[model samples]
Target: MEATSSGRRSKQIRAKKRIEQLKAFYIHLAVFIIVNIIVIAGAVSGNMNNGQSFGEAFFNFNTFSTFIFWGIGVLFHGFKVFSYNPFFSKAWEERQIQKYMDADRDEMKKYS
Candidate 1:
């Protein structure tokens, strides 16, 4: 009974931590959107003040550079929060470990 209770507590703690990570990632995304909007608006206005047309100012790379760069960081953060590793997952690692162990066993049988 105590072991089950402890296991449940451990799982609860891990879940709480995961929830916190998700919340932090969401906050980061919100801040990224808010800040980028302000930055883009400022850049557009600055460019227009400098005599560029509204369309040119709005479409300029400088106007969205911060959004693009910071968005990359936000995307990475989201991926990390969600455990989205394309190249290496827990199942993949386990399969690789099993494959190596089987190969070693086969090699040992040949030696025997």
Candidate 2:
């Protein structure tokens, strides 16, 4: 009975945490998407389209930078170059979990 209850509690806790983490992840992703749209729109509005070459356009040193190109390119990558996680990365997942846990503390305290 004791073991069963402990397992159940653990499962519940894990589920709650997972749900919170997903919420946080979605919130971050939504904001990122919105920001990306705005940035792209601004660039387009300013007639910031393609350059002389694809390389020059992507690695715009006189503008954003090649570093930015790599940064965005590898936003969801690690270990291998081609095979990589993009949206919800391991580091990103942990960060979002922490963010969610922090946000839920007050609500948790109320229950406690």
* lDDT (10s digit) by residue, model 1, range 2-108: 99999999999999999999999999999998999899999999999999999999999889999999999999898899999888988999999999999999999
- Candidate 2 runs further than 4 Å off: 48-112
Candidate 2 lDDT over residue span 32-111, tens digit each: 66765666455544544543445444344443443356446445432233335666688998999999998899779999
The residue pairs in collision within model 1 are none
True-structure RMSD, every candidate: 2.1, 13.0
Over 4 Å off in model 1, which ranges? 103-112
